[model samples]
Target: GPKVLQIPSHQIIDMGQMVTLNCDPVSNHLYFYWYKQILGQQMEFLVNFYNGKVMEKSKLFKDQFSVERPDGSYFTLKIQPTALEDSAVYFCASSVAGLSNERLFFGHGTKLSVL
Candidate 1:
């Protein structure tokens, strides 16, 4: 079975700092996506990337957030100048295709806290 793993189950950071969350997606998958869920809110799509460029990004993907593969290694999401509102459970997901893709497999999530 395919699986995605996220490191640092919990992270606490001060405001205005940079944070990079790591994700190890299923080996055979190509498309990668990031989603964020604030406390008691529905999960929202942030961005999707494939073939070295962003395929789609939602309004939630603010200017401070970026995603990259960087040599087929772990998928990473970096947030620079973090804000209080950035605190949420970040989930990493991957799929085989974009349009016809089925349900995404998500990691447990990395809980981030910004103060």
Candidate 2:
């Protein structure tokens, strides 16, 4: 079975600092996605990436957030100048296929806190 792994299950940071969350996606999977959920809100899509380029990004992906795959390694999400509003559970998901109908496997999530 395939799985996605997220590191530093919890992160506490200052409001103006930078944070880079790590995600190890299932091997051989080509599509990766990032999603965020506030304490009581529904999960919102942030961005999707494939073939070394961004496939789609929602408005929720602010200028401070970025995603990348360096040397086919684990997918990563970096947020600079973190804000209090950025506190949320960030999830990393991967799918074998890039189709909308494909099933995604999600990591437990990295809970981020900004103070």
Candidate 3:
């Protein structure tokens, strides 16, 4: 598995506030992804990014959420006017290939607390 590092292990924000989670994925990986997991629940896919574009996103990825990796910098997931339901542990992952055949490497995850 590749190594993925996510900054700010824990984030606490008020409801309707905005937040951005940063991930430093494997340098050579071609695909990046975000997943959300609530306590005692399974991890749910949010979105995947490749070649500076968003390739796919699940319904869980609300309109307020955006992702980007400017100039090959940190892969980021930003949420504006976040809701209380948005609170969860966000996992960042990367792989050499697409979601189907590649082995994904995941970060520990950034826990978000929206009050």
**Residue lDDT tens for model 2, 4-83:** 99998999999999999999999989999999999999999999999888999999999999999999997999999899
- Candidate 3 all-Cα RMSD: 1.1
Inter-residue clash pairs, candidate 1? none
Query: Least accurate stretch of 10 residues (summed lDDT) in model 1?
Result: 96-105
Judging by TM-score against the true structure, name the best candidate: 2
Candidate 1: stretches off by over 4 Å: none
Model 1 global lDDT (CA atoms, 0 to 1):
0.93
Candidate 1 global TM-score: 0.95
In model 2, where do residues sit more than 4 Å from their true spots? none
Clashing pairs in 2: none
- Give the Cα lDDT of each candidate: 0.93, 0.95, 0.95
What's model 1's lDDT at 44? 98
- Model 2 lDDT-worst window of ten: 94-103
Candidate 1 per-residue lDDT over residues 1-115, each given as its tens digit:
7889998889999999999999998887789999999999999999999987888999999999999999999899999989999999999998877557377878999999999
**True-structure RMSD, every candidate:** 1.0, 0.8, 1.1
